[model samples]
Target chain A: MLGRIEQKVLRGGRLTPEEALALFETDDIHLLGRLADTAAERRSRGRAYFVQNRHINHTNLCLNRCRFCAFSRSKGERGAFELSTEEVLERLEGSPEGLSELHMVGGLHPEWPFEHYLELLRAVKERFPRLGIKAFTAVEVDHFSRISGLSLRETLARLKESGLDLMPGGGAEIFSEGVRKRLCPEKITAERWLEVHRTAHELGIRTNATMLYGHIESYADRVDHMIRLRRLQDDTGGFQAFIPLSYHPFNTEIRGGRPSGIDDLRTIAVSRLVLDNFDHIKAYWVMLGEKLTQVALLFGADDIDGTVVEEKITHAAGALTSEGLTREALIGLIRGAGKVPVERDAFYRELNLYGDRYEDRQGDGAEAPDRFRTARARQ
Target chain B: MRKRLHPEGVVTFVVDRNINYTNVCINRCRFCAYYRGPDSPEAFVLGRDELFRKIEETLEEGGTQILLQGGLHPGLDLSFYLEMLRSIKERFDINIHGFSPPEIHYIAGRANLTVGETLQSLRDAGLDSIPGGGAEILSDRVRQVLSPRKIRSAEWLEVMEEAHRLGMRTTATMMFGSVEGPEDIVEHLDALRGLQDRTGGFTAFIPWSFQPKNTELGETVQDRPLGAGGAEYLRIVAVSRLYLDNFPNIQASWVTQGIKMAQVALRFGANDFGSTMIEENVVRAAGVSYRASRRGIVDAIRSAGFKPAQRDTHYNIIRRL
Candidate 1:
């Protein structure tokens, strides 16, 4: 019964922790790996992908004091900062050229009119009409909705009309209230975060999902986070990927915390093993560094995040990354890991291999059934 | 190699900077939202001067080591690393605890050298040790599905073993919580345990969660099971101490799990508080929140009902915990 559901949920044909831990003690490591490998491989079947874009932190100024945040700057703080559209556009221009997407998000400012964001997107679109904008998290959306007295749909629609292509997965720190209250109490509740994402999906705008792990949360809570996301994905099919956000406990409001390496690995492996509906398991290179991210691939992560020509919020949080990247460097890292380097669009669709041509990216349309069958037979 | 963290009278610890020389990478592993492509204006390889400046800063701050790691970029040559290591050694008094399994594998493949020879060359060039990295859930099934193109389970261990025999001490790791079943977790443990029984080279075993942000995978499924808590984290810590019987010191993962869990881990299994990390990115980008001070490590260990001891990268407790 246990293995049955395990396979159904993850397709890895493994048993639950309660069952597997018992066998692990007895040194049945091979059987265990087989089961985990299966589940991980199948869970993210077509979705292990990454995007080519840049991240823009419009402002670190905020009214709320979310506990888990290290990047938020109170308006009165010496470190508080807000970028004008011109400043943001300068940052965008400095963004790696040929980038098709712009990832914009920051704190929910109390003073900036909601239309400030709209205007920012509008200006960017007018300046770079071809570039897609995947901006704002659910919490930011909630902040905008309340501040503007607009419905979630109306808000998203207005943004879309203003060039908001999609939503960036943020603010879903964890689904458990116990943890939320202790970690980020002032932020939108987990339910509201989900509601906004659900609303975004309902409106036909795709978004991403994330979990900021390695902080004050439990294994069950991690599992609950995944189950809830799976259910949501089943409902909307709007979530394009699952990025495991590693919580960095530095310059943050929280106390008594540090990063957990093993826990991070467990989350990634387990995510691929259990999140049967999600496609991609990304190692956010910015957070995990390339070494762990590369290792994450073997553990069940297929996608490495894209070129962040400029990542502000993390830098403001003291990420130490002050420079952007060139595509050659990225391809070098992927190929160095012995994986094929493919560039992806804002959505999960494959644009082509890093070095492949547009025509080469042309999906061969449905693998010749016989070819895959033969390949499987060869296996 | 007697790779054991034997407690000594002096609590020896070294100051180091984890120089991720470059954020440029090709592997688009989900759970990662970092890494820029070549030509990505964001992309960069730490030039010698830039790296030297970092080392100079660390040295100025009394740092004695450098844990240099980066994505598996194809352009870097063995000479590149050799030059960097040589430069660091030539410039400052620093120990190089750099490179992981996948990196060695890539280096070997790129240079057409064996893992043993690769370690041998790097060690000859002032490379001191390897971190417990990329040993994410060590199941081929999980590896193929998640990072299909990276090293396989056997390869990861094989590289570690090669490092062990090559006289390079290394660490083992398990990244759980994604799609892995309990059995998969077990398999990861057993693999590490068996390796320890053989080579006894793995200095410590660390486990962590996945961080999904700014990546392709971050676009799909909502991150579930949030993250491990003190209780669950302790359970794993205790289990590792209990399970990796051949392994002696299990380092509490203060880097990803935080100090509270690290303190709790001492009771369960972990005896060593990890390095006084000057900089860490991978897990932080995934959103794990916290940083530990050297004094904080001492305090946390004391609070956890143990003496806080400082140790070198080799697990030899210089200070009593």
Candidate 2:
């Protein structure tokens, strides 16, 4: 017999908490996959989207060393590093000319004034006016709010004025109160993290959402986390995508095994199904190994992240997936799945449509990398 | 593969009975063990009461359609088909998915009507869709050796074209692993693809192995393999998904391959589970009795990690689990 919630799904209605929880309990993983695929297809059609961006972790030195975090460090811990505004710009220079976005996130620095972050964003904008700077998780924002003595709205407004294009989805490890208490006690509360994004959305600063799974959280915890995000997406509509971050356990204070491949795929499929209103579901290749990332395209993930160059967050957690992939390689993965590869910007605008006729944008004679440099230099 | 392709995680099946209304056939294809000649005492055409009983049982089982197919009985006229369709449609308000191309061609020839006229008369009598039966291999070379007395390949395509022109939909099938090679499989898929490109009327593609037991062709075709295995079936299903890009849905034949292989095929690119066959006689006559109830199909699909959804004849979801 059809469950009442599943009957509503058949009738094209949104999922309730009871329905969401029931979806997890049901043994029908394929039905979960099918529902996720239907939702993904409804949003993306046959096109799988990715971007050409670089990740810049400004600093690793921090005050809050959350147990799940391997990237955060004490004042003089070995491998602790911080980049100045000039160093950040010099690193940005090495990126390919077609680089469209910058992903920036790091620990909560103790002594550095909030002016350092403002200057970093300003310097990045001054050097590459065309770059979209997606910086700061809600945790970092909360830290900044505490240090600067500003409200969430005012803190977000100041960051937006300083060239923060969007907010990176992080700090939402697991939403259950017990999970939050156990996972990252020093970090902002789950409600506070959501409030930061909610305020960002209300201020017209679109952001993404994420959930770190396969750790201490139960299945109910994961479902409740996604349901909260779904409800938030329903209210503000500022969430562009949902990335289900698989918990990698290597150097963390907690010692647990990583999720299996099937678990990763199931989480992605369920995330796609549960977050119906969100347009894109991302498979961060930096966390899910390269092959699984390609497989995830066929699962429920339409966005295989981007050419992340140097992604230190998951690497700190002992992730085996390569730190980055080239634009051509990303396109190859999407096309290998028999889907159209579209080059999208941070805000989901089509930068280029790489149809059946694939023109190598990296040094190919047809479309040279220097073309982007020339176009930007003209400005 | 299931999640990326469908994203909605809903795998669907229909609760319908494959009612072989008549077992008497004139074109008795060699590989078929189901048909009986008119002179045989065992030959039978369903009486009105029996047909209604089957249909009522179907409704009681929560079935939404009756897939009425059979051999081309020379004694039966077009009036018999028209009345059967009208009777079912008038009484039950259920979908009448009756008649393959060969049966339609045989009816047209017997009534001295054009294929279009025969389809129109059937449609007027409340025929909803055509099932792709008798399409063993679209290659005529194989057809010549397989079933020469049946309508040729061109005639089958012609009947489908006429049905599509009349704005009616149909399903396509390939009965492989019988005297045909890899090229023949490609040829079959290409033929279906070409027609789909023109008409865009095929709702789904079904591929099943040719069952050969207690049949003359099974013994006569020396050196020929009996049928394909699960691996081969999966390879063909995956290739069909890649080849038939225009085709929206591909079905796995759980009725032939059994439940386990069908469940595995969900990963190999089959989005639709063929049917919960409340009644199946044709394949059963060939000495393979694999039964599937609605609950069984739902369980199998759920085990495969997909949500089971009930669908009508048109592939529209009636309910979801």
Candidates' DockQ values?
A: 0.04, 0.01
What would the per-residue lDDT of candidate 1 be over residues A8-89, giving only the tens digit for each residue?
A: 5453343355443333232222233344445545554423345668888888888777776777878889878889999989
TM-score of each: 0.56, 0.55
> Which candidate tops DockQ?
1
TM-score of chain B of each: 0.90, 0.97
Error of 2 at A54 (Å): 0.4
For candidate 1, lDDT tens digit of each residue in B264-312? 4554556666677777776666756566666666655554445555556
Off by over 4 Å in 1: A1-48, A320-323, A354-379, B1-320
**Which ranges of candidate 2 are over 4 A from the true structure?**
A1-7, A357-379, B1-321
True contacts kept of each: 0.00, 0.00
Q: Candidate 1 docking category?
A: incorrect
Candidate lDDT values, in order: 0.69, 0.82
